[model samples]
Target: MSFRLTELAEADLECIAAYTAKQWGEAQALTYTGQLTHAFRKLGGTPSMPGSRKRDDLAEGCRILAVEKHLIVYRHHAGLTEILRILHQRMDLLLQRLF
Candidate 1:
């Protein structure tokens, strides 16, 4: 059950990197990115691993996984897991039109 990042997810990662780099430093940004990537890989290996919660409003198989202060939104389909977005926990996902 391999996973892939969607275009929006990739853009979210880039935005997170940029924001972390500006607020903290390049090192912090790189470290955080690595952490997120690790989470992605883990999910790829175990697509059914319990997420923070189910998001039926988003999609049939949509779920959210929490890594630190961020939420990894993904959906499982046809043996592939598609990452939908990575958002800060404080962000209003509904208001952001993530669902």
Candidate 2:
């Protein structure tokens, strides 16, 4: 099945990039973006993985993950999974927790 990332997800990445750029320069931000995108793409095929989350407040139909030090949120619908957002693992992950 094909997958798409939500606009919020894209914007989340941009926010990270901007933050990282201000602190570590654009190169690091771009590099981190690449990693985030890779993880997002890897979300394909498997509807859910061991460290993934399914949030209700955001999309009402979403999935998520806390990989490394970052959080990747997504959703699978009609055979297609779309990433919703990405953020620091330490960033209020309660919303993405498996509770």
Compose the digit string of candidate 1's lDDT tens values, residues 1-99: 489998889999999999999999999999999999999888887876766578877767788999988999988787787899999999987766453
Instruction: Mark the regions of model 1 whose C-alpha exceeds 4 Å error after superposition.
Output: none
**Clashing residue pairs for model 2:** 53-64, 63-74
Each model's backbone clash number = 0, 2
Give the TM-score of each candidate: 0.89, 0.73
Instruction: Identify the leading candidate in terms of lDDT.
Output: 1
lDDT of 2: 0.72
Mark the 10 consecutive residues where model 1 has the least summed lDDT.
90-99
Worst 10 residues of 2 by lDDT: 90-99
Evaluate all candidate structures by whole-model CA lDDT and list the values in order: 0.86, 0.72
Error of 2 at 43 (Å): 0.4
TM-score of model number 2: 0.73
